[model samples]
Target: MSDGKEMRRPGGRSARVRAAVHQATLELLEERRWEEISIPLVAERAGVHQATLYRRWGTMPALLDDVVDEWSSTTAALPDTGTLRGDLEVYAAAVAAPLQDSLVPLILRAVVLEIRPGEPRTPSRAFRERERQLQAMLDRARDRGEQVPTLAELLEVVVAPLYFYALFSVPLPAADAGRLVDRLLGLVGQKA
Candidate 1:
C-alpha cells in the first residue's frame, strides 16, 4: 500500500549511506593520491554497492566534489570577534591551517580541473562556502556601523594570496593571516 511519491526520512538510510561513503573516500584520499582512487575501490571500502555510488554521484569528479563540499562546510566555522578585522584574521588563519595538510592541495587541484561538457564553469563549493562566511561577517560589520570592503575585494586582496600559497605548497605562517587582514582593511580605507 504505497503512493507514487517517495518519502524521505530524517537521519535515515540515505544519510547513513552518504556518511559511510564520505568516510571511505576521505580514508582513501589520506592513504593515496587522488589519481589512484576509483569508484570500485571506494564502493568496496564503503561497503556499498558500486551501482549505488554510480547512480548517486554519476562520476568520480562528482563524487569528489560532494566529498569536498561536505568537508569544507563542516570545517569552516564563521567567527564573531566583534570587529571585522579580528573576524577576518581568525577566518584567514582557519583557511591557511587546512592547506598545511598535504592532501588538501591535491584534492583542490582535482576539483578545480573537473570539467563537464555541458556544464558552465562555476566556483567550487568550498569557494562558495567561504563567500557565505565572509558575507555573514560583513553583514555583522555593517550592523555595527563599520565600513567593510566588497566581497569581491575581500576575496581578491585577502583570500587569493592565502589560497595561492597553499596551491603552491608554500608554508603559510599564522602571522601572514593577520598581515593579509591588515592589507585588506588598509586598501579599503579602514583601520586594521
Candidate 2:
C-alpha cells in the first residue's frame, strides 16, 4: 500500500496522497468546524507536507468543495419503486445513512453557513448537478404513471427541514429519518 498505487486507477502516488488528504480532512471535520480546518492541519493529519495539500486543493473552500463532491458521488444509486413514497424512502435511507457518520453533521453545518441572511439562495453548482440527477429519478416515477408535482421550486422545501433538524439538535435517527422521508414523500402527489 505504501507504493501509493491504487489498483483501480493509474494516478499512483498523487492519487494516494489525495485520498489520504481527503480522508484526513473528513476525520478533522468530525472534531472541528470548517473554519477551524487548515491545510497545515490536514497535512499533519494526513502525514503529508503542507505543500502537498496546498498544491492539490489550493484553498479551504476548494478543499471543502472536493470533499462534498466526493460525498455526493459516492452514494448508491437512487431507488425507483414506482410509488413516490417508496422511491423517496430509499433516497432518504441513503441520505440518512451518512448522518450517522460524525463528520457528516459538521459538513451539513458548513453547508448552512453558505447561505446568506437576506438573499435568494442559489444552489451550488455541484448541488444543482446532483439535484438534477435526483430529479431524473423522480421523472422516472412520472413516466411509470405515477403522479409527480411541478418540482421547479420544491427541492429546497424537501431537503431544508431535514438538514435544519440534523444541524441543530437531536439528529434524527436513521429509522426516524426514514419515516420523515415517507411522510414527505406522501405530501407529494402520488398515483393510486
Candidate 3:
C-alpha cells in the first residue's frame, strides 16, 4: 500500500474518457471523411493516450461502430401523437432534422460499411427500435378503428424517402415531413 500511483475510480475517469473520445470522434467526422480518421488522431483530439484508444476500442472500425451506435441512440425520441399521421409527421421531422448535420451522413455511412453479417449491428438495433415505435403507433390506430398502413409500408413509403434524401445530401425542407406523411397516408388509402 506504499505505492505512489493514483487509482482510478471505477466509472468516473472511464466515463469522462469515453465521452471525450466520442466527442472528438464526432468533431473529426464533421471535418474529415471516415477513411481519414485514425486511432492516433482520435487519441490526440481526445487528449487520451494512444494506448487508451487501442485498449478501449482495439481498431478504427470498432471505434467508429461504437460512435455511430452512441450517436444513433441519442437521436430524436419516438413521437406519440395518438393518430398515425400525426405521429409520422413528428417522427419524420425529427428524423430529417439530424440529416442536416454534416456528421450524421458520415456516421451513417460508417455504420453501413462496418456492419458485419450475423453481428449485432447499429443499423439492426436502430431498425428494431423504429419497428417497435411504428408497431406501437400502428396498434394504437387499429385499436381506435382507424385504418393504417403496415410497418413495412410506412418504412417503404415514408422512412425510405427521408433516408434516401439524407444519404444523398438532398435538401429536405421542413415542409417535406408533412408532405411525406401525406404521401404515405394517401398511398394507403387514408385521407390526409
lDDT of all predictions, in order shown?
Answer: 0.78, 0.68, 0.78
lDDT of 3 by residue, 125-160 (tens): 555765787788889988988888888888888888
Give the TM-score of each candidate: 0.76, 0.78, 0.79
Please identify model 2 stretches exceeding 4 Å from their true place: 1-10, 80-83, 113-121, 152-158, 188-192
If both were scored by lDDT, which would come out higher, candidate 2 or candidate 3?
3
Best candidate, TM-score: 3
For candidate 2, give the lDDT of residue 52.
Answer: 67
Q: What is the Cα root-mean-square deviation between model 1 and the actual structure?
A: 4.0
Give each model's clash number. 0, 0, 0
At residue 34, what lDDT does model 2 achieve? 66
Ranking by TM-score: 3, 2, 1
Q: How far is 190's C-alpha from truth in model 1 (Å)?
A: 3.5
